[model samples]
Target: MRLITCSNSAPAYPAPTDTVLRTGAAGGLVPHLLALLRDGGDWLFPVRGRDEPRWPDRIGPVRLRPVPVDETDRRAHYETISVELLLWLFHYLHDTVAEPAFDARLGRAWAAYRRVNAAVADRVPAAADPDALVLVNDYHLMLVPGMLSGRPRVVYAHQVPWCEPDYFGLLPAAVRREILGSLLACHSVVFHSTRWADAFVRCCERYLPGVTRTGETIEHPGGRTRVVAVPLPVDAAAVRALTTADRTGAWRTELDRMADGRRALVRVDRLDLWKNHLRGFAAYDELLRRRPGLADDVWLLAVVARPRHRTPRHLAYESACRAAVARLNETWRRPKGPDPVTLLDATDPADTRHRAIAALSTADVVLINPTYDGFNLVAKEAALASETSRILLSRTAGAHDYLAPLVTSLDPCDVDATATAMQAALDRPVALPDPPSARRLRTAIGADTSADWLAAVLGTPRTGTAGRDVHPTN
Candidate 1:
């Protein structure tokens, strides 16, 4: 089975040893696919928008070269112009249907979308093999499936296609129809959760006009669209192995020394608005405000955010978070002692791992409050590794649906409610689960590793989960 996975960025980049770029999305998926290919499967990895210093003639002995889309600026202009214009028109039209509060800067979004599409079109071919099964990923490559004459294509939506009413309400009906028609014409559609899947179908009908639902609707489409909610999985065993390393005892000791036998409230997130990091901090701040003595007893450790793109909004948000942390530290000071909340730089991977494991080991509470998330893999990872009490979870996160029982659920939008949950997490007396129970949870999660998800999606025999087992390389 020659399985191919393509994306906007490569799994790894060849940067100078000293000057390293922070690993982001591309860092997340490419490694899993490469690992699987090395183990047993035959795989083809092709990423667009890459400039290698030494252009490889082949990847793992497979002939490799960029596939050109058009002669005129590599079709980038046409592709970008088409998609960005469509996005704005669709967002304007769908705003009333999805939600009135959905606010995305459409003009800014359009500009970014145009740049992304241009890059994608520069890489994808003008025409592709209709017989080769194509698994297109994200909105950046939305036009790829449409370009193929009669291919068995599968689209995996990472975000709500027509999300945020204020944003998606701009697109005209005709453009939306063509986009949905192009996507629905595919053999299958995959979403991270049922909520987004349902929203996607609604967008199709509201904008596509004549589109109708057929068969048992996972989501209602104007035509025969097969939608499935296949949640993404993490590499649980590797996570545990990394966290449970015996050689990292010195780092653990230093972290433990900092803890001073107090309850540790930890959150690991990029400084993004959608992550609700400020709200999470406010919750911890509230916990300290109400129980003055507990402020001295508990420490909130946040991983500092990396410098993202040179966007004004991104810079502004990062500054706001830094200010908030500083204010909290000033407001709740330890009498003649160190700061209550410690903010570590995001680039410190070794420390991040050590602190994450130590937090899981010593946590009285692990808080993950996202404004909206397809699913928070960290929640599951923390839960599996946790030797303490229930996690403080945000209801908007997809993992909330699955791990509700093990979490102290609250609205991510409400700071007060989150504050209350944080207090509850600190005050409530619940005994830690025995080793056997913790082991069982870890086992269940390990069964659904990234390898399992890939195998099932590719129609290969998966490890378990019925006969959906794919062949795993040794």
Candidate 2:
């Protein structure tokens, strides 16, 4: 089958099969999928941006059709729709929309969003093979599957969390209708977990009349969309290479030296509202206060991945997190011991991936406390980073249930509970990778794997040659 993929932004790095995917925010997806698709097959991932035209259409067999839009419309589309509307729609942030020309801006956003998708829809027919599988990723292009004509198998993959019908109802009826209706047009609607998959099914049942959900499949007038939770895996080999002692040994060595031979806890995340960085800091602070002696032992190495465009919220979050760190250091920093809290947001993020992995490699615990994340790959990568490091994960995280059995779970918002769990994880016995449980984790995380994810999304049985991935635990 001919494989075609579409995403809101281009891959962060040069993507699969010698494809030079110009820089954009594709969420490090290219590498994960690159590792997955081991067998040979034709694939295309159409992308759009103001600078997209400079890149060629085809890099070897992988076609990157540039669907460029006007500059002004692109800005309005990216700022309002992709960043604001979709993130707000998912309730990633609790703040109310506060911007000039809110409704009018939303109108422009919707128009630009549609324009990008329509341009992409126009490109599909040229590359459409007899049996084509067009995989649409992210909330940015929910309308693409519906806009495209028949013959190409469409799979709409929602990488983020799906809101409940009541919260989704908050959107204007027309907006919510378009979102659900277009998503229902796909051959499959994939999510990171059964939690979000079930939410999508429920929303379809609530909003779209006559839509029936049988097991994991949603049937509507358009067709059946198999709703499955296929969590994407971390690029384990790449992470291991990054953490190699020769490349970044100083990171862990320094962390241990600073911690005065005690525990070093590393929390690496994009400095975003949804990441709950503030709460994580507060929990750590509380833990230190509760057990002052522990402060000399446990240290927090916050390696935040700063965004390219720092919004007001991002700046404010950075400010607040810094203040908390300063306060923690003032209270707990021992002259001869750990610094108490160190926030590393000033470094070049392009080069920090290896450093973060290196730091986590020597950590006693890794904290991933997202308030409500669709799927936090950092948690998976952290687990892969160390055999002895205990992971303290958020219960609301999409990977929580799958990982909870293996890692310590905590409520993201509960400061007291999080602090308790942090201490517990610090004390938890280090279970070396062994037996049925560890085997399941390794399988779920794309360890020693191939392209079963592609097959699963395409509704085809996994061939013997293809490797493994997380199947629906529900």
Candidate 3:
């Protein structure tokens, strides 16, 4: 069967030979696509740039088509709209307390957003058969499904706590209706967790009149949309291979030297607002202050990657994080002792991947304290990649759904609680074995590879609790 999927950026399948790196949740979907292609699934995706050659047009059974955006000005406008407006809107990143005002510039950006989606929709039919299964990905192409009405299509949401009615109300009424109507045009919708799925359904019910939900399916004027929750699984074998590689060993040695006999608390994430870098630093500082004896014995290794688009806000956040780290080091560093916190840049993909694996392997505690996340893959990756048994995760993270019972869950907004969890984790016996729940989670994630995830997304019947209520008493 012919399959077509659209995403904002092309996956870096067969990792580039250059030093250029691709990271984040957008590239996270690449491995699953690669697995599908290896298993003989016919797939097609658009490459963004007009200047870049479409070398290796076909990888195994998958085909690559370049959707040229030759106009540089329009391309930038489209990207600005997607990142600054649409992304923030869907991710709930805006400050609701402050009244928001939209000017004509935003209207122009929305127009560019429409143009970008139209460009993607224009390429879909040419790349697929008349009866092909079209799968649109994420908020970037929310309008693509509506554009391809009467065809079998699915749209997958990669963000959490899907848009509420108030969030939608921020947009002009016409734009809001257009987006909801476009989504309703799809035959099916998918999310990484049940919480996000429920939010999406609730938003529809609140905003769109005559919308009805029945057992994970939502019916509206255009069509009935089947909502499915399939948590994205980690490529355990790949992560294992990376962690066990020869380079990883060398990196581990270097990391050990850097640690200087101090226990390492590792956190790997992009420098973004929702990642909660500042709060994490505050928690670590609190941990150091509360346990003076352990201050010289413990270190925070924050392996933060640069943001995809270096907006002003991202730059300011990075500056603030650096200042916080500096302050913590000044206050907590003992005579001739290592800095209490070490920040590492993960801009080079190959080097970053190796360093991350090494950090995970050597970590005594892995801290994944995101204010919100779609699915914090770092938590899962740490579970598989680390020799350590302790992980402190945020309750708001979607990964908490699967790993709550296994991890030390903390309210990321609560600094004292996070500090307490960190202290408790550091104080735990090093010889203590991993919890049975943690082992089960690791096994379950490993067993369900990206191949299985792809099959389920493409309509393969599978039974299990992917969206079960997992409340951990911590």
Which digits, one per residue and each the tens of the lDDT, describe model 3 over residues 1-474?
556767665556443442222233323665555554553433334444654474455554556555655464355444566667667776677766762346776676667667767777877755345666676777767777777766765555454446667676887777777777888887777777677777778878877889999997798877688776677777777788888899889989988998999989999888877899899899988877777877778889998888778788789989999999999889998888788899988756767677787888889999998877877778878888865658999877878877876688889899989999999998899888777876666677667665566556555745432323343222
For residues 1-474, what per-residue lDDT tens digits would candidate 1 score against the true structure?
Answer: 333434443434433442222233412344445554443322222333334324344444332333332233323333333333432232232234653221354434444444444454344333344344445565555654454435454444453223543344445444455456667766667655555565677776666655666532434343355665556666666666756787335556766777777667887666655677788888888777778888788888775455333245457877888888899989988778667887766455435555555555556678898877666677776776665655888776766655555677778878888888888777777674545644554565667766666555554636644122111110
Q: What is the C-alpha lDDT of each candidate?
A: 0.56, 0.71, 0.72
Better of 1 and 3 by TM-score: 3
List TM-score per model, in order: 0.77, 0.89, 0.90
Clashing pairs in 3: none
Report clash pairs, candidate 2. none
Sorted by TM-score, highest first, which candidate order results?
3, 2, 1
In model 3, how large is the Cα lDDT of residue 82? 61
Best candidate according to TM-score: 3
Is 2 or 3 the stronger prediction by TM-score?
3
